[model samples]
Target: MLTQLSLPKLQIPFLCHGQFMVRVLVVSQAVAVVLAFAPGVYGDVWARLGFISVFVHWISIITTLCLCAARHKINQLKPISIISVVLCIFLTLTLIVSAVAFSLFSTLFNSINHEMSDFLAKNLMVAFIVALVAVQFLIVHAEKSEQLNAQTHAELNALQARIQPHFLFNTLNTVAELTHIDADAAEKSLLALSALFRAALDVGKLVPLQTELELAKQYLSLEQWRLGRRMNVNWQIPDALPAIQIPALTIQPLLENAIRYGIENSAEVGKLNIFSIESRNALTIVITNPYYQSIKSSGGNGIALDNIRQRLMLQYGSSASLTFGNSEGLYRVKLVIPKS
Candidate 1:
């Protein structure tokens, strides 16, 4: 069954994120600075700034802690419900912090005179306004993020779809040709094709490196059967392949391109080599095949290579790369995947 991609739900900004926390602190300080410089007549500007900073920081820290504690449950709520709950939290925290700070100031600094009711009301009003603005910003950010994700998934699905029909036609043609010579071999090819199709259709964005290697092997097996004496493959994989997640169908498409442009086009037997090198920070896979400059194979427009490159970019950003070029009479394709 084909599963359609769903847009990600709107989520409250996690206070646990360092960036969110830093922004909160910075904004709080900015508010304190603005309050200190406001038109109201104040005794000492620095003292007023300090007092406001302490009060706002207290409210901000407590609110952040409370939200962080309940973030998991809050995230599961509907968007409107999340906003209501978060606003309620902010208002409640503001009231409590204001009451406590007012009592402390009254007790410790008798010179300062402010009514508890007025202070509490002021804090609650400010908190409500700030919370409303922040919530609106978060909602907008989440919506934009969700839309970007949906667009990426759509593009990925389209790119993935492009590969499938090409793969199916080529495999089916090979099987059809094989059926004339050997019925049993054609049946085995069909079974392999079924596994390949299942993996192609069912796989998510990422799969284990070993799984991709297996898929590549299955693809090569089909090609080997079709090409007979002309197809040759060499594997230099590690005994203990690094435990890493790779984009699905990462290797098979490259191998298909290799066979189509290199082995199938060549008159003599072509050597295809697949090897991997693992480093502390990254894993690299290299595929090489005999390159004949004279043989102009049809459909060498590099659709498969481009699809894989886009998928790699979407999956790993700049941390992964796919590069291919003719080097030393062999067409070499190098794929680098970050281990992190």
Candidate 2:
């Protein structure tokens, strides 16, 4: 049921300024109509202006909606530019017919003359043109936004792909190291290694929180087997937080980094703490490991930390954060994911 939802579809948040501008234009037009055309309410320029303004606003909105809908349909065809041009011609014809009908209805049954009707028709035509311009501007703006998002996604996928090889190299080396000392352990490690690689290959760049955490557990199990008593793994995650989604292998790679750095640097066994915090709107995963001061001071390895940051940015843009620093004697990685 959850898989059917396709919840990862990307969308842009609506801007208040854009909505405000549309509202202002709509309100200004409505007010102008009330002032100008109100029968016997005002006997000045305000009345005439109001009459024309309201009419202009109404006509503009209708024409714009028509053009926008037609443009959207045309977009489903071949070239959008060609479709837009054709749609504009159709818009002109629609406006002409509407203006003629409005003028005939107003003049034949009322006090307005042909001269006034002609002026009204001209105003309607101008409104249609204004509406067309607005729709075109909106289309251009939407397309630019989509292109930028596409570029960001492409950069992120490239980053994810680059980070995969480093982990593969490490795992293969571990498998090689364990082969001779304990034949049975090495065979089990190989099986776990195969499962880990298969999961990594089959899973998408992003997955449900439950799926990622499951993968993380499998990964940790394999590492623990390889590291033997030299690695200590501790997990503290509530059951409620499993519903929140995250990038696949996001936590695992960070854990791998911690393990690699901690175990390699420590003369004795090193402890790793993997925990999650579920707040109202965010689910944060913290991976902490004890490291020697020398390893902590050496700083980034250009693999796990940077890779995770790039993936989060690609998936959540500015909405998610990945941070690393030393607190007390432990080096820690904290990934803050927005609650899905």
Candidate 3:
């Protein structure tokens, strides 16, 4: 849970939801057509349509600017009240622009004042009713998207809270086992353990790849006090590692699983190999080890893998992955993270 939920939450600002500019353009174009024909007692239908198009786009731009300016205060209002306020503003703009539109229409076509007045009044009312529906559609759609993201975050936080205690208990066991045989190493392990507690339990955000790698190294060092040379690690990394960010404890659990299932079960001194591949847009980490198929725990990778997958989903959605499988003569686990 810490691995996934610690990643950033999806955010949509109140007035800056997706495709807002495009929605404004499309609604303005649509309303222009309908308003042009609403005044049936008009000459040259094409001329009237052209005239309305100008103010339709004009009104849309002004209304959008006003809403964006007041977005901070408006977001605090109740949903029903928000709708009422939006319509009131739309109606107010319509009333304000009506006289200007009437004068222009009369001048352009030499229409009588009475006819132009009727046309402007009827069209502005039509614009209000149409614009109200369009505005509400955009607001409701954005609200639903934000709500879904919020629920996902809540679930991840709850999962992180529950799993952290289990992880702490397991770490304490490793320290307890080291006390009798090697007091000096146990003391060092306690020091390393303190860092792990801060990195894991009090996670503020994803750490750099180098930072995560060192933590993994510390974990393996602590384990070696008990396992000795049996826990062999071959780290194949570039001289200058890429600046990649990953969730805390992202690679540590995988190493623990390797020791328990691959290293511990092997009759010969077990070897583990870890390396990285940096591409233009992604970082891929591969961990390979020798294992006995017969000794594999049926539920070996369940919780840890689930946790990693969850974290990836939270951070990168479906783009990032944790894939593990045994093939040929080696068991391989590959993790892919997007650079973005």
Shift in Å, residue 156, candidate 2: 6.9
Model 3 agreement with the true structure over 1-340: per-residue lDDT tens digits: 1232322322213343336667777878887787667655467777767777887887777777788677657756655556667777777787677667776566776433476558667766686667668655656655664565466446446655655565557667778987887788778989987877777663435888889889988877766765777878899977687777777778887887777678877788889999998888688999987766743454645556766777665555555789988877567889998775
Runs of candidate 2 exceeding 4 Å displacement: 1-10, 13-188, 202-204, 293-303
The C-alpha local distance difference test score for the whole of candidate 2 amounts to 0.63
Residue runs of model 3 more than 4 Å from their true location after superposition: 1-9, 12-183, 294-297
Model 1 residue 301 CA deviation in Å: 4.8
Put down candidate 2 lDDT per residue, 132-210, tens digits, no spaces. Answer: 5654555565565466556655654665576567666767777788786777777877777776776666433557888
**Steric clash pairs (candidate 3):** 4-311
Candidate 1 lDDT: 0.78
TM-score per candidate, in order? 0.57, 0.54, 0.54
User: Which stretches of model 1 miss by more than 4 angstroms?
Assistant: 1-166, 180-184, 292-301
Give residue 228's lDDT in candidate 2 (0 to 100). Answer: 78
Model 1: residue 106 alpha-carbon error in angstroms: 23
Q: Please give, for residues 8-101, the per-residue lDDT of candidate 1 as tens digits.
A: 3557544655566788899999888887778864577777778889989888878898887897689778766777898999899889888888
User: Which of candidates 1 and 3 reaches a greater lDDT?
Assistant: 1
Ranking 1 against 2 by lDDT, winner: 1
Error of 3 at 106 (Å): 27
Task: Give me the candidate number with maximum lDDT.
Answer: 1
Superposing all C-alpha atoms, what RMSD in Å does each candidate have to the true structure? 7.5, 10.2, 9.5
